[model samples]
Structure formats: structure tokens, C-alpha cells
Target: MFPIRDHNPSGRTPFVTYALIAINMLVFLGYWGQFSAPGLDQFFYTWGLVPEQILSGRGGLTLITHMFLHGGWMHLLGNMLFLWIFGDNMEDAFGHLRYLGFYILCGLAAAALQIAGDPTSNGPMVGASGAIAGVLGGYLLLFPRAKVDVLLIFIVFFRIFAIQAWIVLGIWFGLQLMNGLGATQDGVAYLAHVGGFVAGAVLTFPALMRRGGVQFWRQTHGQPPHPQAKYRLAPSHIPRVPRK
Candidate 1:
């Protein structure tokens, strides 16, 4: 199951989140389909975070650039979707500038951990998953009881369920940790995700303290500080076919 939306609504427009989505999209469009497989590999090597390159004391700028370079459309879409779902609330909490800074710091922490995980590996890591994972982390801390609508698919059957944020993010973080430990040539930077998530939570701690820590949870009931958004899922119009 994956989340499609959250009930927590920001008090104001999340300009930074929207700008991040747009920037990622535009950067993807700028280079997508413009290169052959080899050329794409070259491009990623140049812009994506390659642990070996950093270890060699070069390609230092990629720590920031790699957050905008996605491996494909699905990669870009998935990351952006998570950001869209969880980012606005964070932007509201941290404000626009602080949120942006938090995002970058998370990305940097992700890169550092990925490099630490496998310093000699030559694979080029690309995507905003790491940074967005940070958003999820912060969201979990501030709004654990917030309702998130997740779409679950099993074979040909599908359903949507509104579940608590902690359950969803907890399961996600667990999976990343499990996969990271058992991973071998999986091509996923699971460690980066883990690192980003941890960084996000740590970075958001001060805000939690400012709000009175555990008392904040008590006051807000671990939900958004304002009224939660309500959604009604419209029934599908398609008629079911009768079995022969």
C-alpha cells in the first residue's frame, strides 16, 4: 500500500514544495530522452552522486545536483507524489526558507550516508527519494495521528484506506532498513533514504520542543494543529460484468 494523500492540510500555500516539484519536473524534462543509454550513464555520472567520485575528492557539487536528477519518469513521479503529500505540512511548520534548508540538509545527509555505506562503489545514485524521505520523517514526528489515504493493490483488486501516519511511515522506514541490511546490488540507495529520514526527524526536533514536545502532541492530539481535511471518495461509474 502507498499513500495518495494526507488529511493534514497546511494553513498556507506551500510555495517551496510546489517550487521543488516544478524544479524537479523541469530538470527531468530538460534531459529526458535527450541521451542514449551510454550518454545517460555519462550524464548521471557527471551529475548524480557517485560515492567513488566523492571519495576521490571530486564531483563535490553533485551532493546538491543529484537531488534533482531522477532515473526515470516513475522515479520522478513517486518522489514528487510523496513530497506533495507530506511536504506542505512541513513547509507550514518550518516555513518556506527553513523547509528548503531542511530539505537540502537531508539530501546532504543522505549522500554522506550513502557514501559511507559503500565508499568504493561506482554506481551513480539519482532521485529525490532521499530528500522526500526526510519530509516523511518530519511529518511522522509532528503529525503521527494524521490520517493518510493509502491505495492498496492486490492482484486485480484495489482499495483505499485511511490509516494513521505513523503506521504508514513506520512500515516504510522499516522496509528501508530491512532492505538496506540485506541489499546486494539492488541499485537502490536505501541507506540514503534511511539517513535522510533520520536527519529530517533530528532536524525537526527543535520545532517539536518549541511547540512543547510531548505537550504539543497532547494539545494537537498528534494531528495537524488545525482542522483535518475531509475527503469523500466517489464511487466508480463502471458497471461490473456478470460472470458467465
Candidate 2:
């Protein structure tokens, strides 16, 4: 399942989120043609976060650079989508500058955790999944009751459902934790997701408490501070076929 949007609207324009999306897109486009280059792998290794290099106290800048790189178009789009959906409200909550700082910190924490998982591996980790995971975590804490529209696809069927933020985020986090625990080696960095999420929740805890902790939840009912938005999807046009 993937979140299509949310019912919470920010009172002010989320400039930082918009800028981030633009930058990610531009960065991807800038090196789009380098995928087939003979030195491409070396390029990624130099810029992407490699646990081995990090452990050796070299390539320290990769932690930040890797956040802007992606393995493919889908990789970039998926991350950008998550950031677009949940980032605005966070930028709204933390303000522009502070939100940027929080995002970087979460990414750093994510990279650290992923590296710790297998520091000797030479595989390069790229993409913004970790940082976006942090945004998801923060969204969950501040708006557990907010409504999120998610697109769910079955083998031959498709549907969209609006669910509570907590349910959506909880399931996402649980999956990350589960996958991280399972024995597997693949492109996806599950540990990064887990780390960023935990970092986000921890970092945002102070803000939550500053808003009065339990009182904050009570006051807003775990929803956005502004009026809740309502959405109605257009009916599907695909004809239903009778089964034999």
C-alpha cells in the first residue's frame, strides 16, 4: 500500500518540502545518463554510503550525498512521493530551517544504523528512504488520528482507502522492523528505515512535549492543528466481469 495523500493541510506553504522535491528531481536528471558509464559503479561508491568506507573514517561526505542519489527512476519517485505526502506538515510543524536540520540528522542516524548492520559490506546505499522514514515517524506522532488515503492493489483489483495515520505508519514501521530482522541481502536498506523512523520519533518528542505532551493530543485529538480536509474519489469505470 502507498499513501496517495493526507487530510491535513498546512496553514502555510511548505516551501522546504517543495524545494527538496525539486532538488531531488534535478539531481537525478543531472546524472540520468551516467547509469551506463563504465565508471558509474565507482561514482556511486564514491558518493553513496558504503558501510566499509564509513567505518574506515573515509568518504564521510557520502552520508549526505547519498540522500540525493537513487538507484533508478522508481527509487527516486517512490521517495519523492513519500516526502511530498508527509513532508509539508512536518515543515509546517518544525518550521523551514529547523525541519531541514531535523531531516539531515535523521538521515545521518539512518546511515549510521545501516552501516552498523554490516559495516564490512561494500554495497553502496543510496536514496532518501531513510530521511523520508523520519518524516513518516514525525507525522505519526503529531497526527496519529489524521486521515490518509492509501492506494491498495490486489492481483487484479485496485482500490483506494482512507485510514488513520497511526495505522498506516504503524504498519509501515512494523514491516521495516520485520524485514530488517529477517535474513536477506538486497538493495533495500530496511535498517535505514527503522533507524530514521526511531530517530524522528525521538527528535520530535521534545516538540511534542513542548506542545504539552498529553495535553497536545487532547487539544488536537491527534489531528492537524488546522481544519481537517475531506476527500471523495471518483468512482471507477472498469466494468465488473462475472466469474464462471
For this target, which candidate reaches the highest lDDT against the unseen true structure?
1
Instruction: Give the deviation of candidate 1 from the true structure as CA RMSD.
Output: 4.2
Which runs of model 2 end up more than 4 angstroms from their true locations? 232-244
TM-scores of all predicted structures: 0.93, 0.93
What is the C-alpha lDDT profile of model 1 across 103-197, one tens digit per residue?
A: 99999998888899899988889999989989989999999999998888999978887889999999999999888877745788999999999
lDDT of all predictions, in order shown? 0.91, 0.90
- Candidate 1 segments exceeding 4 Å error: 35-37, 234-244
Model 1 residue-pair collision total: 0
lDDT (tens digit, per residue) of candidate 2 on 1-244: 7888998988779999999899999999998898898888998898999999889889999989999999899999999999998999999889999999999999999998999888898989999999999999998998999988888888988887778999999999998999998835666899999999999999899889989999999999998878877656732355779999
